[model samples]
Target: MAPSYLSIALIVLGEAFASQLPLFETSSLSQTHLTAKELISSKSLQDRIHVDNLLERANTLYSIAQLGEDEYNHPTRVIGSKGHLGTIDYIYSTIAQLGDYYTLSNQSFPAVVGNVFESRLVLGSEVPQSAIAMSLTPPTKKKQPVFGPLALVSNFGCDASDYLDLTSKIALISRGDCPFGTKSSLAGRAGAIAAVIYNNEKGALGGTLGTPSPDHIATFSISDSDAALYIKKLKDGEEVQASAYIDAIVESIETTNIIAQTKEGDPENCVMLGGHSDSVTEGPGINDDGSGSLTLLEVATQLVNYRVNNCVRFAWWAGEEEGLLGSDYYVSVLSPEENLKIRLFMDYDMLASPNFAYQVYNATNSLNPVGSEELRDLYTEFYTSKGLNFTYIPFDGRSDYDAFIKHGIPGGGIATGAEGVKTEKERQVFGGVAGDWYDPCYHQLCDDVGNVNLTAWELNTKLVAHSVATYARSFDGYPKRTGIEATAVLDVPLSKYHGPKLQV
Candidate 1:
């Protein structure tokens, strides 16, 4: 059972402690006399989350994706695709059927969707090697293939000198030191027709150029082994001829963000939780965010059985894969009065990576909002109480929480893992392979229903439920809302921070 306190003491002590702790505060004590609902405990809500039921729902979503697979030529729920539209309809219809318990609405916005039809590299008549085109790169308009002599760029291709006179040629560059966009821009400035960036490590390179750039020529990624072979041949005084072909589509499309808010709770102090509803072009993204999306749906359904003091809003964000587009748009459109009503925002993305670790966002370090530390501590306490080990992920804006924190809303959340390789120490603690990706099939076609770690998914969902239930009852230890005008963080471009480019 959770601890309890007297109403006056809770509020008075909260104010007294607010000076010492930036993330601590409480609502007015006068409002304590408001009629309280017959609420269920967090443990009761956690116990109500059945793993079998969760899996069954997840499988149904996968089936929906299967039905919509023909449109995209792959099983994906990417925004503006049939699969994602179906996903939105399903979520909206399901919550709408819950009677008058919640108020639901679909917030529509325009998003630039990028589709790579086919990308290839042919090296001197050898079999065409598989390559992934950088997202948002303009498709080649020329009918003839771009054929030119390949020249190696010096020092990761980030400097002007690295790209000398190389008219009508292709640049072969190593990936490091800067964003893939910066390197491609340099290649364009050097008069190169295209650019191919090879991985610095021992694997196939797959990444985004961050955003659309007119200066960015056609760019593709290749395996480190292939790059090494090309370098060796060049070192041996052999001229290597390369041909690059890319078929892609980049266009603006309309998408929706599903927002549902409880009707019975205090509307002024709302608790918001979200996860991206869209997937990559490769696969169904069942585990990538289908896990988080469904977990929220399941919890929201069960929460209808109880009541709360503060409103609970569930947001299924779209356009996260194209650089946090949907969530950013949602925050950008909020008026100052509307923004103040949101007390805090919690995000959940990739909650069930196969090589899982219980990771809470480390709000104590970077990008800490007023009440972020308290949110982090709450999650930490929840896992510790369950006799489970946990770790902290840096609070870099890599998920839906990015825009919320940037807008001064206290934020925190959990992730099982993404494409990051697990260390030996992490393996010992989490009981998974040391040198393998957290989600081996991340952003790939195999990230279907079977890719999730059921144990991790179930446990993380329970923690989410716990957080929701605790905050719904009262904002005893949360920061008081201040109607300060929020400055747009999007005005300044997001830096070239690299990691697993899963969601955001």
Candidate 2:
């Protein structure tokens, strides 16, 4: 006969407690000791949050990013970089202060990370236009720049026939027909030494090649106006000689994900909240994710003062900008039984876009688990209670929640915005510039501490505290997971949602 609910609960509890490693850092437990045993509530936790604390933390992250500026020539917390490693240390040390209240462990995994030292595009010896190196592009040999005559590819460089006899020439391609990876591959195959992909829309382009390929040459993304100038020159039979310098390298490195859980809660049922700790290659990422990660950190810090009947796992994921590498690796390792113990998962990413909108993930996707809608309702109710207007964003799987949702784990989260433009309707509701991107500095050099909107970030942080405290105290109203096989819930289409990676 199959095991009863009590037996399964007992088994999960025993295994969870047995497998949990002890808190590794023991030095400063006396300094930030936990004493309160009162039940966690929205008021109790939200009252502890302060905007000053968030600002101080964001400033600290900026300083850490600045420490690695000598290597990248920019302050960035990209994975495998000095800034990101420093960030990992910061999170670990911060959580370690509450040594007796939580069990902390670092999950180390091998990841292929890309680094771009320089991305330069100069037309006819004029000043270099603003350009960013596409991630995963192979570095030029011995730091040598590739100089060649610019040749425009017919169509969007999606096919081989679109190229002319381009041996030792650079291919100038438009960005509409296909993925950046396809264009780069075709350009290299056509004997082009380098390639430039211009955006189809406004603003500077910051992109990735999805994955590294031997056929991908030194590819860079430029704005549409720059592409237009070159196209006009080429159309007039002008010899637009181009010089491309892309210093980039892809290498395998070990990255760490910091996992911390309350030691006093029931281990069988857990409420997991996560945010990516690494940033893109362009900037300090203070707003893009520093806001979200620091929010979780701040909440976790304050949470130690209260008691929880259900487990609360706070995760600082690594390699998120590289397509949710850390979270994906995490879920892939969980056994079916282990997957069920995680009652629900909530992801927080980019909570403070400069021109922000209160977005709640509408878990209306048919593939989302039974309790996903309930999770959405929880966030909506919080916003409603505060008389705040919020818009519903689809469960597009753009962040760390993609991995959890794939395994039928009930999930939902909040995002201020990313590269998407703010609609006029959104402006009327949230009152920001409609024509501009929600976060113009997203994935660019301008995404530093100044990019964060303190007002929006603080509000969202309170919501995070509210949701975490609610679930931590009890999953009473939340749907209980039936002891169904994990495979049964794995029917969600993985291809439907794009995690962090932009197809363009």
Q: In every candidate, how many clashes are there? A: 0, 0
Q: After superposing candidate 2, which stretches have Cα over 4 Å from the reference?
A: 1-36, 122-131, 148-166, 172-178, 198-205, 223-243, 365-367, 423-425, 432-434, 444-446, 482-501
Error of 2 at 392 (Å): 1.9
Can you list the residue pairs that collide in candidate 1? none
Instruction: List the global CA lDDT of all models.
Output: 0.78, 0.81
Regions more than 4 Å wrong, model 1:
1-37, 123-131, 141-144, 153-162, 174-178, 199-204, 223-239, 483-494, 497-504
Write down the lDDT that model 1 would get: 0.78
Q: At residue 487, what lDDT does model 1 achieve?
A: 29
TM-score of each: 0.84, 0.82
Report model 1's TM-score to 2 decimal places.
0.84
